[model samples]
Target: MDINCTTYELEVLHKIADAADALKLPCYLIGGFVRDKIIGRPTKDADIVCIGDGIELAHKVASSFSPKPYVAFFKNFGTAQIKIPTPSSEGSDTLNHLQLFEIEFVGARKESYQQTSRKPMVAPGNLTDDQNRRDFTINALAISLNKHDFGQLLDPFNGLKAIQKGIIETPLAPDETFSDDPLRMMRAIRFAAQLNFTITPATFEAIKANANRIKIVSQERITDELNKIVLSTKPSIGFDLLSKSGLLQLIFPQMMLLHGAENVEGMGHKDNFYHTLQVLDNIAAHTNDLWLRWAAILHDIAKPQTKKFEQGHGFTFHGHEVVGARMVPKIFSRLKLPLNEKMRLVQKLVELHLRPISLTKENITDSAVRRLLFDAGENIDDLMLLCHADITSKNKHKVKKYQQNFELVRMRMAEVEAKDHLRNWQPPITGELIMATFNLTPSREVGIIKDAIREAILDGIIPNHFDAAHTFMLQKAAMLNLYPVQQP
Candidate 1:
């Protein structure tokens, strides 16, 4: 098959072909570039595999360009890369109004792995050897960039058929392939989630049989794939596959703990596992934010920990949000996720997810809305989205009622936020100012006055003005029996 390529793409391919011919090397455009093009997905990167010194071939290709793109080669890995800039008009995608065509060159090679490690011992080999080492069959497809067989299609493993069928399978024996590099197990689930493809039953079973092998992979690599899965359009597909393949049990058993529902006095709550997945899919429908999606995945994570069955009540997960928020840091650390603002965002969203829902059930108040806005800060919108996604009840009437009530909560929040200006609101009374006004060093009394001022404003007892807060601070200080020192 002639792979459809833009004029710029064809130009780059022809340059590589010419360079390969000059060096008497057989080169092919291989891997993701070929697969994505066949499936009509926009791609800006291409992988070129040659039978000779790939780094040298990259230099030749670079020289052929007018500006001579820089060649970055890795001697230890026998690979090289160059990024060619193309005008936005001719580019597949533009970044800063300029698009980059990244081409990576690697000599065709074979790989064998030790029983203890996923790192492969590499050596020079043929194109077929390189294809055989690919993680998935669809990714192993290649296109000829040679002269006589220019634009020729190479399908040594019928990967095109797998693409047509929306299937993910390894080119070699599934067991050997996964055992060689256990990271491929995560890759399989990732592809299924990303492309909405199905893993063949045999391949999935192989993953289950060797799920424990994933322990050999580094946390960073595994978390990288997990993040990709989380970022997919319908991430639940990948998470479900991960659970069924037992990879979730090994990689994120905390999530796996949310699997089952127990009946107490013939009253059972929704399966927290599937409910979390539904929330994930729900949040995905509204936003593409990865951290928001993560909040959905973890919103009910502590339900299993806080589950309780009272004599009159069926099942209650009271304080789950608080517990789950506390668990976010440990989970992020374990998964190698960022411990920065991103983690804190997820934690904050988890803590506040139920607040809006609780408001929907009760009589909405300005103080409550102000506190929600103040606590959620700039994340109020994201918190609202997560709460809306959390309403996964199968009953349509119940869903509608909750949605209507939730809308009321939103309206109240907007009104309060407009008047109170509480979203990302800073307390008017600074601790330094409190200390200054009280004519005292930093002390518990200063903190108490500050808290009292902030509370009075949030409670609407005082205006959110420096004057009102200053007056309240004095009253609070007087109550503490600490009068301000006279000005010098």
Candidate 2:
């Protein structure tokens, strides 16, 4: 299949072909760029494989430009990369007006791996050998860059057929493919999720059989693929595959805890696992924020721990939001995910996932809305999104009712925010001012008075103004027999 190359892309191919011809070396465009081109996916990255010194070819191509671009060469890997800058329509010479296209050049080579490590022993080889070493058939497709065979596709493995069939099949034996580099297992699932493709049955079973091999892969690499899957159009496809293939249990058993439901006295709870996926897909429809998606994945993470059976009530996962919030840090640490504000955002959402739901069910009071806005602060909209996505009941009536209540809660939150300005709200009173006014050092009394003022504002007992908080603070302090140093 001939891919319709863009004008700039054709220019790049022509330059590379000219360079290869001058050096008397064969070259082809291979891997993801080729695959995505056939699938009509927009791609900025290209891989060119030559049957000669890749670094030399890269330098030759770099010289073709008026002001030669920098070629980053990796001697150990026999690979080189050139970042070609495209001129912008603005006609500006500034770097901001330039777009970069990454072209990776590699010498055609084969690899052999030891059972213990994913790293391979590389050696120079023909194009067929390089294709044989590819992880998936669809990724093995290559387009020639020689004058005689320019744009001709080389499909030794019928990778074009695999692309047509929307199938992810290994170029070689599935067992060897995954066992050699267990990271491929995650890639398989990621590709399937990204392209809406299916892994061949044999490849799926091989993944299951070699699931334990994933432990050898680095956590950074594993999580990288996991993040890609999470960011896919419909992430649940990849996650469900992970669970069924037994990879989820090995990598993330905490999520597996949400799988099954228990029944007693003719009462049962929804499977929290599937429920979480539904919430994830729901949130995905509204936003592409990875942290928000993570919040959905972990919103009910502690349901298993907090699950309790009651005589009248079927099951109650009390304080699950709080418990799940506590679990986020450890999980993030284990997965090698960034433990920065991103982690805190997910934790905060997990902790507050149920607050909006509770407000929706009960009377939507201004005080409740004020408190929600205060706690959620800048993330109020995200919290509401999570709550809306959390509604996954099979009962259409219940779903409709919850949605209506959610709208009411949103309206109440907006009204209260406009009136009280409670988003990111801190009490008008400060602990330092309270201490100075009372002529006392930092003590439990200051904490008590500070908390009282905050609670009063949240409960609507006093306005969020300094005068009201000061008045209430003095009264509470008077009751505690702690008078101010001097009267105002």
Off by over 4 Å in 1: 91-98, 484-488
lDDT of 2 by residue, 71-131 (tens): 9999999999999776453344444326788899999999999999999999999999999
Pairs that clash in candidate 1: none
lDDT of 1 by residue, 384-424 (tens): 99999999788999999999998888888888877888888
User: If scored against the real structure, what TM-score would every candidate get?
Assistant: 0.96, 0.94
* lDDT measured at residue 170 in model 2 versus the true structure, 0 to 100: 97
- How high a TM-score does candidate 1 get? 0.96
